[model samples]
Target: MLTKEFDKPLQILDQDGQVVGPLPPNLAPDRLLEWYRMMWLTRFLSNKLVALQRQGRATTWIPSNGQEATAVGLATPLLEQDWLTASPREMGGYLQKGVSPAAVAYFCRGYPPPPELVGKDARCLPFTIVIGTQTLHSVGLAMAAKMRNENSVVVGTCGDGATSEGDFSEALNFAGVYHAPLVMVVVNNGWAISVPSHKQYAAKHLAMRGIGFGLPARLVDGNDILAVHAVMEEAVANARAGGGPTLVECVTHRQAAHSTSDDPTRYCPPENLALWETRDPLKRFRRFLYDGGYLDEKADKALTLEIEAYMNEEVQRAYDYPAPAPESFFDKVYAEPTPRLARQREEVRQETGAKR
Candidate 1:
């Protein structure tokens, strides 16, 4: 029987990889391998990104080292028509949403993103590097959907530290009061750069903030892919059915520090390292697959080789990408540049002694 706790937060698998309850009813056995592949691909992609940053191919990168399950699982329930607003660590979500591997890797380069990823027909928004702005964008999208009588639900993801921002609160409050069909997913990976959660919020649980907005909210085991998917699927359903906003707090770990520039050892203790390792999502999920007879040593070895080959191809493609043209910056600013911006653009060109 499913634990009552599992109903509210809904964890499908325990740390030891034992099924805590029945699998998601709609999920087919044939599809489980696909989800596992996406999760593994996320890990492989993240490893490549870190290497790219180290080799100076990309300017900055926030490694989603421990965040694959949280991103990939929650993304599984999203229909192609549903909108998704994501923070920077959304490569996993993008991949699930049909973003190509080459497109994902090339975007991080100091160049225009490949046409496949950022084309006019793509559903995803450009990644928001600013902390909490995507919350407002998500709220706006939900509001527009409501106006259009569109039944699609929208999801916005942010870091745990983003909750401290006023924009995050305002977005939730507005979303609740308006009963906007949106899901606010907070991936609490335990640190915002040098600051830990203890220093960031006084509340015991981040999901409790949804109460203030008079919306349904709950926390979940972020590392458990099945658990995160089950809960987020329900949350998405509720939103699409016009039950209004839901706040989902996903408790996961960063495993690595904040980004390429960060050094977690400066703040976190070695014991903290040992603790999270025991709860490693990849290890835990692998065991779940093994116990269920869905995976074996042969499958694992072949999958590793497959992913490694893909990563190597992506790294080479990223290396060959051309630098963005100087004029490309001015192109995305607006439909038509304002007079001040036009003047500033010319001024910058003149100052840099560049061709018109």
Candidate 2:
């Protein structure tokens, strides 16, 4: 049986980005570069989305500003067939899992998700706006996968605040009892909205909750991409091997506000935020690449320009797309609309002067 590691958070990179612990044996320089690119892309996209939101092109968005390491690391190891149920802040994971920037942009604007995000073959569920609900969906998916004797593992990610929800507890109980092939990742970014972690739970570490459910658990340095990837890889492997669920608590900080609607300065102290800035995952990882000679100023500048150009084009396309038709709301809810819904649909059609 896999055991819980209740010690300090696992970390492979120091704040200086130098390897402070043993590196993963399988990680190569090229793979590290790829990981760096993904993290950079995720960060850039998140920043751009926030900018778009400010400019009224996008709706409220959860910025994954400081959590790129945790997002990309956890996602990089998953196979194409593996399923992911993620929160809004996990746009990094979504992008890493082959989700398109255009699709994400459209979704953020309250439009229908791009076709790429729909259907079973997408291998990723839409972002769960409701806290802790995705855990149940992940458990259900894992249970079904186990029933079919498939090797696929279902991963569910949520923030620290989600752990307090009843659905989270129930899902953990079900996953434990059935030994479902699920991995629950808690991105413990110290705040569940405006509430800090100290007030959210009494436990010293959230990973302890998983131990109570009879599953292996680990506390990981969410800023250390290598550590996050290493820990998740083991958890995924164990789940695929039929060892059951594991809960990984990624300890990081939400550098940005909870969403575009929130104001973190109202609750979070500036000093605390500044302290975390010193450990910014992107900055740390960039230093590592530079020190290793994998990235230089010229290459970094070129990559930044390339990604920015791509993002600008995609954002413009999303902005140019027509708004959702009024009729579309009444459609897709059912194969055949109910009597009341059918009447409402006609009312919308008449009100909007939309035909067919």
Candidate 3:
């Protein structure tokens, strides 16, 4: 039942970082720097987190490493009040959306995620570790926007593997039927754990899935930050104008393992890694910056130092902050603790007393 109007994918930039079409006048030098800064900040945090995991400082870790473009580009076009629901690998989007460095570090360290993550107080949403479950959350948020007649749109993000989940399909169906103001962005990194993308789904392209649900869809080379920003701008503008939902599938590569516990060597070859390295999102963006005279060798060096210092500060802050007390678990689980939870809390208290 979907319209076939969107035949060719939308893109504003080529793989070499040149714009395929006109750059939006509004995104002139000053505004473009904002996007670059966000991406740099996220990349800095991602590298630090990987080090933290390796050093055993972090218990839970999911690094966005090479996928910086997809997150930052999509987030740049969103309003400050719009909602964002993301998978674990999308800490970059939170950074781009203005989540504080300390809060992100705390959450990734498993030391009580920030409150802003769960509430509308901040545009960011707490990540759903259960894969594609947040698709329904996005649908629900969009549905709420519709009921309230608000201009707010909900942008949900997921990995390629998430598309394999039933919740993803159901969310799209419901959102499409109601013409909800939602944008589903799939960061298809071509690998879902040890399984290659081909093994995970039979579809030729993830973007095509939107057609079945009656939604507008497009594919983009995720490494091209300019293209990502442009497409997201168009998509977000459409949704806010009450044009309903759009599905964007960004074809990028995962430069790291599924998690700290995963090893890509089990399935990926050395040449495959090398191929993606040449297409590193950061390098591509840097090329664009250099070619446009937006950055010089001195500026690049200074920026690198700045990012390193910032990340070191975040690491220190995370370590200095105290971990949440055992009671925090009890408090977060329910508004009013049930009798069973109350009893369990008492038991834990008793056990601690006995040990002391």
lDDT of each: 0.80, 0.86, 0.80
Q: How far off is residue 289 in model 2, in Å?
A: 1.2
Query: TM-score of every model?
Result: 0.91, 0.94, 0.92
> Roughly what TM-score does model 2 have, to 2 decimal places?
0.94
lDDT of 3 by residue, 1-356 (tens): 12333444455666566667667557687676667777788878877777888888776677787788898887878887688999768777777777777777777667556554333355767778898999999999999999999889889988889999999999999989999999899998888888789888887789989989989887877877887887788888899989999999988888888788888888898888887677677777777788888888798889788877886786677677666655556767889999999898888777765655
Q: In model 2, which runs have C-alpha deviations exceeding 4 angstroms?
A: 116-120, 352-356
Query: Please, what are the lDDT tens digits per residue for candidate 2 over residues 1-356?
Result: 45556678988898889888778788788889888878877888888999989998788899998999999888878998899999879888877787777778888788666564333355888888999999999999999999999879998898889999999999999999999999999999999888989999999999999878888898999999999998999999999988999999999878888999988889889897787678799888889889889899999889878887887787666767677777777787898889999999888888887443
Candidate 3 clash pair list = none
lDDT of candidate model 3 versus the reference:
0.80
Count clashing residue pairs in model 3. Answer: 0
User: Which candidate ranks first by lDDT, i.e. highest?
Assistant: 2
Residue 203, model 2, lDDT? 96
Q: Tell me the deviation in Å of residue 342 in model 2.
A: 2.4
Top-TM-score candidate index: 2
